[model samples]
Target: MSNIPFTLHTQNSAAINVSLLYAASSKYEGEWSGTPHSHPYAEFFYVLRGEIDFQAEGEPYSLHEDDLIVINPDVNHTERPRGPGTVEYVSFGVEGLCMDPADSGMWSSCSLFHCRQSRSEVRFFLRLLLAEFENNLPNYEQLCCHAFESLLVFLKRAHPQELAVTAPKRTARECSAVKRYIDANFRQPISLDHLAEVSQLNKYYLAHAFREYIGLSPINYLNSRRVEEARVLLRDTSHSISEIAGIVGFSSQSYFAQVFQKAVGESPGEYRKRLRRGRQEKQE
Candidate 1:
């Protein structure tokens, strides 16, 4: 399967390397007050649960769960809970990337950028960042740098108009409905009929459009999504190999092992064991 290349716009210029200075998580309830302030470091935050009314540079944003906001260096912003329910979020203080936020057109109009449509991608990298930050495994700092770079791509994709003049954005949206459907229901037995029904297009037409938009057939994309979720479970949970296989929609443990090894270049059990070993070695 072809991979989507996500770049950070480092062409013909010195690349920016970001470092994670501090990372923490908080869960709060009820109405709260925020202290408006600015710093020399960039900060990334995600609303893990509940909602918040976030304000930055005099603009008010009502953000719900999964919403992301990147606060530029030395820009003032604050977040207050929107309702009574608890709001859990993870945040990181970053340095080295925001030396001059104005170099990127996104920070010109506003110091805080909102990423509304990239919750899944952002969370994926954010999870890895937190994991690496806490464990301090070998090459963890380098891994966090790459995670932050992926986040830059998500930010760029979320608001392509904010990119530099020389950089062009190529995005696919015509078959987004099919992709979203598969992501949400990959655990079920899915067929071309189900995909076409969900996309409101003919099966053959949907196949051509899906392949054009994402460079993968509908079934292939489905398998990829399942495999991605399986990796998360393997890294974070204590589930057995067979249980994880079933949880991620594979019919049997052996088939799941084959697909996962082909895609990830290692068996699921081996990968999980390696990750855990590396993590424990560094943490200890």
Candidate 2:
């Protein structure tokens, strides 16, 4: 019998502090039910079966089996079944980690990678981490976290040009500050010029950097915030549509309706009516 030898080496490295917040596996049949939304943490997805289409930051991409994607914080994205087959995938919500590419042509917020050659290895880590989370035995959380960090190491090695995990740049920090400001004062008459004054960054650079870091231009982000608040008010309050529009910082109801439809796929009145109808049906 031939003998094989293996050696292990150790090197100094800084600790990457990341917490695996959650993991989920989903299978969607025909008539997928997904909404455009975003979160403030990094998310990872691996397609296990079939094809799916992902719209991230207004760009469309079709992904097949053995493919993975990483989305940065505050990036708007949605996914649905592609073609005619069922879609199955596993996703992980991670915090305290961000990814940027060494080259151009790939948005740091939405990075897609095809992994046909490393399918088995990729699936192994994903499935293992998922199983550990599902099992929830002793030290399962620790195990899952370790597995996820190891998976990141593997991915960086495999996609060196694409997965250069690094700290947030200065611009990203400034953009984040602006995002927080918007969150607090979206109902005000905020503009790019005002934001520039607040952040002390140029208007053009602030717009571009905000989009690069947050996945939407400043105005777009403001509009999205207004839409989100409008949705809540429509569902909960009996306020008139126009009043809601003005309260959410829109100049006119017509413009509010236009932006709301583009973001939510329905007019505000229609959404409110549908919600009320559902509530009435439940009560009846």
Candidate 3:
């Protein structure tokens, strides 16, 4: 048991300010040693390396690699390494930020216990947070804050324990599978019927469940995904508009341009030129 007081990283302090109390990373070897403590600030932790045996307000929980846990303000909690292997993680605290209890609005609702069951979603968020922590770019703190809020919302939908009404017992699980599929196949033409068949649910039920839990219908979500891919292509690749459009599942460049403008508020070519100019100005 090592009595290491959590070390705070100060690099982000200027941007985060005092309202965001602290952010730190730690690795534990062999045991649980820290005092069972509670803080006035809300705390969020992401396990990056190994498993941790966590005890929060007398409830036992285990967090594996890529797992996330949130301890709301003043929740008594303690954690120890699950084994001899090292447990590495990052944590941050938020002050003067609290959620309303009755909101129960998916993950946005205030709750003492929130956990992420999806490894991919947890990993995605951890990488995003690590990027912000490592690179203190302008507005990185705000990016991290938004990412944290998104994480809470994701956990609310991904974690069964936080759900208010009973969804069919496997609602979250099936939704996770469906989401992963969409993420993987977003660039391809994916149909709602196919998505429903893949998830083993009726189309109408799948639509309702997906929107209720993931906040997007299959087709609308797919188009949004295609637009996101298009933005990446526009900024990072030299592929022609038609080529990029086809690659991202859009049937025609004209159609893609219209959708991109609708979503991004500018034509793809215009957006790309703006980004290039912004980069050039930065270099100047």
Return the TM-score for candidate 3, rounded to 2 decimals: 0.48
Ranking by TM-score: 2, 1, 3
**Span of 10 residues, lowest total lDDT, candidate 3:** 1-10
Ten residues in sequence with the least summed lDDT for candidate 1: 165-174
Estimate the TM-score of every prediction.
Answer: 0.48, 0.59, 0.48
Best-fitting candidate, measured by TM-score? 2
**lDDT by residue (tens digit), candidate 2, 139-232:** 7766676667677667767787665664434475567668768878999999899999999999999998888766789999999999999999
The candidate with the higher lDDT, 1 or 3, is 1
lDDT of each: 0.69, 0.78, 0.67
lDDT by residue (29-135, candidate 3, tens digit) is: 77767677866656777787888888765567878777666665555678888768888998877664433223243312123332445666756765776677667
Which stretches of model 2 miss by more than 4 angstroms?
A: 1-14, 103-107, 168-284
Question: How well does model 1 score by local distance difference test?
Answer: 0.69
User: Mind giving the per-residue lDDT tens digits that candidate 1 earns over 131-219?
Assistant: 87778788776787788778767766665554431221111233554665676788888888888887778899878767754568898
